[model samples]
Target: MPRDAEDRRLEPFEWNSEESVRYEVAIEVIGEGVAHYSALLNAAEAAGDEPEAARLRAEIGACVEERYRLRATDHEGVTQVLHKYRALLRAPGDHDA
Candidate 1:
């Protein structure tokens, strides 16, 4: 199936500056980390391992904390809130204009 405009994960970039590209890459890296740990967290929960799940949740919380340096994330329990964090990637003015 073909994907629509909204299906795109990243916005179009015209390769303006090195700093901007690097900043965007950093955001993507954090996002990938989130995805990775979230999957492991899910697996841990499915296996009925609370200890491992808590560990992964902490890892995820740390990654999320770094991703949003301005705001702290108080992640409570197992949440499927990954989608909500996607907007954080674009909201930060981390790049130099």
Candidate 2:
């Protein structure tokens, strides 16, 4: 299936906490790979290399699709985190503690 705009905007949190560092690195690598592939595809097209451009374009498309998929999953994860935190905040005993 195709990805939506929201899927493209989901961002991983920073690595200030040890528990999230690995996820941060993975997200960075996927993001960079997508960027690199996209740049190469554009450069090939600009150079009038139709064949090479087509190949690179396909590769970039695949990378972008994967990125979008990851973004969607991340968005869901973020939503869950927000819900969990909100619930904690609303707990009775935690009101002043």
lDDT of each model, Cα atoms only? 0.56, 0.53
lDDT of 2 by residue, 45-80 (tens): 889989877776676576455545543335454444
Rate residue 77 of model 2 by lDDT. Answer: 49
**What is the lDDT for 95 in model 2?**
18
| Runs of candidate 1 exceeding 4 Å displacement | 1-16, 70-97
List model 1 lDDT by residue over 8-38, tens digit each: 5344645446545445555566777677677
Tell how far residue 82 is off in model 1, in angstroms: 20
TM-score of each: 0.55, 0.46
Candidate 2 weakest lDDT stretch, 10 residues: 88-97
Q: Which residue pairs in candidate 1 collide?
A: none
Worst 10 residues of 1 by lDDT: 70-79
lDDT of 2: 0.53
